[model samples]
Target: MKYEGKIVLVTGARRGVGRLLAEHFLNQGAQVIGFSRHEDDEAQLPGYTPLAVDVGDPESVARGFEQVRKQFGRVDIVINNAAVLTSQYAMIMPAGAAKGMLDANILGTFLVSREAAKLMRKSKWGRIINIGSMAASLEPMGDSIYAATKAAIATLANVMAKEFAALNITCNTLGITAIETDMLGQLPKDKIDAVIAGLPLPRYATAEDIFNVVDFFASERSGYVTAQTVFLGGVN
Candidate 1:
């Protein structure tokens, strides 16, 4: 139980990678708080607390953390996993769609990390893991906005690592390639196949693969591992 008695907050925890991470933390004896746009019944599981929040909204995020303070007192780990992937070429991307991605993917991550850091600073120990995408560096077609948003996240992690270092809090970005999730399902079969063909590995990454890296960052051993971007797909 590496995370025994720790408090972990996972955004987008209703499904996909976020849900898997929340469950894993709970199994490791950590108190898990889930922040999602909608309520999830699975959060009823022992040691899991669900918070309905729109991470893009400052008021909503503030309210969510307020509840966390009321119930848990502090946050030990924050997994900024809530994001939206919109595929469109730069020229054809809609203005509204671009703004939406910026709000949910960039601003959302910033808000959660900002609030969580306050709680973590009190304890002088915390791990901030920002989920990123290989598309940022890969420059895949039809993902200009999505890739840009992830690129911003990687940059944010780098700067935050330095800003929060004195408080003993570490920030790192985990950039993953294609994974089996709803985000992948949105892509055309041809596009998905092309991504797989480009990967050096035979299979795409899994929720467990992402979890393994996150678990490492959550441990005491990774106290010095900050300002780094770790890619899981073996592409780079």
Candidate 2:
């Protein structure tokens, strides 16, 4: 659909791919509401509103949506992108490390998607695009917690798609490979290279690469596609 008048909300929009998604919507003339844990950046783009919010907190997610409703009146599309990759090794994982991963990746998604659906239900039309990871499917060496959370998200999307289809709403997940984002900064160079070598494609995913799929989901043409996890690694 035309984004000219559509209201889009993107989580984790302070930087990385989430920021790019927000930017794409704004460029298309949509009113964008961006939720970030960080303070609003100085280099603000037009047609976008940045709100500091931690999606894992139900109160914060609710407050963020309240502001979006007040500012844009309603939301048509929601991109759940805020996630954590702090757990490097399952054996060394701290007391609450796994719980922390679930809080941000699973519970956070549940909270935000639930709120966004409320607004979309009003219009009887909505799109929910989850930002997932290939690690969820591949289960790489040290990503047990992260993988589990994303796996849960994928299932969540599947169920939401079934329930929301009657209301003309769509829910889906995009399981992406390694992208050169802040999330990747946590790993060492050799580890990163090992990851890059695993992908069928030579290059890592760019923010633009992920945004393309998100853009497709935001379109009227994608109304019939839901509950599917589109993996965007190079021909694997």
Root-mean-square deviation (CA) per prediction? 1.1, 1.6
Q: Candidate 1, residues 49-143: lDDT per residue as tens digits? A: 99999999999999999999999899999999999888988999899999999999999999999999999999999999998988888888899
lDDT of 2 by residue, 97-141 (tens): 777888999999999998888889889999999999888877878
For model 1, how big is the CA root-mean-square deviation? 1.1
Give all candidates' CA lDDT scores. Answer: 0.90, 0.85
Let me know the TM-score candidate 2 reaches against the reference structure: 0.94
Q: Model 1, 128: alpha-carbon shift in Å?
A: 0.1
**Which candidate number maximizes lDDT?**
1
Which candidate wins on TM-score? 1
- Output the worst ten-in-a-row residue range by lDDT, candidate 2: 227-236
Model 1 lDDT, residue 51, Cα: 92
Which regions of candidate 1 deviate over 4 angstroms?
Answer: none
Each candidate's TM vs. the true structure? 0.97, 0.94
